[model samples]
Target: FYIHYIASTLKILHEEGYIYRDLKALRASCAQPVYFSPFVKASNVLLVEGRPVLIDFGMCKNISKTGRTYSVCGTYHAMAPEVRALSGLDHDTRAATTSGYGYPVDFWGLGILLVELLTGKPPFGYRNGDIGDLFELSRGSPSTIHWAAGFEPSRDLRDLVESLLQPDPSKRLADWNATLNHPYFAGITDDMLPPEWDSDLGTEL
Candidate 1:
């Protein structure tokens, strides 16, 4: 139920030239997320009418030609591999896969959420009680996904989740049209739009 909402949330962030970089279910020690540390990256959100709305943006940055940002930002489990590889502001993806980094990292988080929703816990158990190696392994291996105790995911949902978990940014789910056409999004069609908007808004809101 929540996975669909998360996927839609991610789609909007991407189209808006913003990437979540981190998405989580934790409430910060402060009333609001601290931002850019264990505080909050982009994952902080609330459910409204069965949809996810991004609630933290301190770590947010405009998409740039460099197509990357340099910071040790984001929860460990939700961190993108590219971010894990960065040393600092000099963080460079030129030598990486060249598929463009940053935002895809957040999609990785979304994948984690899908597993969690179905399994009653994260794909990998969090012994540390936080989002650590979950993101680390997610960036390196999507096969680590574990099915929930009694539930079996449809092959189609499993495939979509696997594609989102891809380690290579270039190979990750990169096409909006393709994603919309995927079986996971099948029942929901282009005609499903808000009363005041057209489906063509393309994240303009």
Candidate 2:
């Protein structure tokens, strides 16, 4: 259900030329005590209506074919490895290669969102309970991300999530339409998707 919802949301968001750089559960709430992100510990997810919504604008940016943005923004736990490297906060803390990173970051975040939706936690979430620790876990082997007990998501969903979590920005989802057509959303249809109220919200940049 979340994969379908996110795919639809991203479809509309990308169609409107916006990149949701910091997509996370925290962003789902309009108001909350703790900041939205995997590392920011908080309980009680209050659902507005029947569907969850993505909030926060501190890190989103405009999508461009040739535009490059550099900023240390977004929830660290939900950030793409490329964004983390660019921010100089990862374990390596080395300067990035200075390439343009935009839509790819959001796609990576979408992958994390899918994982959290299925398992009630993000793939890199660990006992460390800090942004840096989450990022470190993300840097570890792929097998580290596994579904917890009582969950049996299909392999297609898992594969799609893995594709989204790929570290290389160049290999992320091409567009929302492409994502919608992916195998993960096999039987999902437009009727099953939710509507976007913020359809006209411009890019943060």
Candidate 3:
């Protein structure tokens, strides 16, 4: 259910030429943030009708027309390597030094979500909310994903997470079609997805 819900959301956003910069767990009722410090994380997720639904669109941006955006914004732990790179800049310098990012950042967040869901924590454990450590850990090699003792995920699941978590956005699983075709989703079918899911996104894997 979580997988389908996330896929459906991404499909819609991609079709509309947008990227859900903040893909962490969100409360269905909290679509908009009232305070200035807005960030997405597992703590924000809320269960609606027993299904996971993302909310808090405060950080979302329309990338359809531009294809990319430079402003870096998102939770420290869930951010992709490219977005994390922006941490090196101060607020004033970010505008000049940031190279911008595309939709693949959300895929990296998805990989973090998968790891958290399976092992009860993100692949690279958070360190006191330090952006430097988070950035370094996120950029670590794929072999850095540590599985908890007694919890061995299947090879397909591991592969999917690794692919999505690729440090380089160019190599990450940024397409919905390619992502859905991964072996981890082998048994999923159209009937099991939400009506909003775009079946034409790509041929089934």
The backbone clash count of each candidate, in order, is 4, 1, 4
Worst 10 residues of 2 by lDDT: 30-39
Clashing pairs in 3: 17-64, 25-45, 26-44, 26-45
Pairs that clash in candidate 1: 22-43, 23-43, 77-131, 77-135
TM-score of 1: 0.65
lDDT of 2 by residue, 1-205 (tens): 5456656777677667778777876665422222233343434332333354565666666665555677767766777777777766566633233464776777878788777755667777643564555554435434556576777878887778767776656665656777777887878775553444342324331
Quote the positional error of residue 117 for candidate 1 in Å.
2.1
Better of 1 and 2 by TM-score: 2
lDDT of each: 0.57, 0.62, 0.66
Q: What is residue 125's positional error in candidate 1, in angstroms?
A: 3.5
Q: Candidate 2 — which residues are off by over 4 angstroms?
A: 29-48, 93-98, 126-141, 193-205
By lDDT, who's the top model here? 3
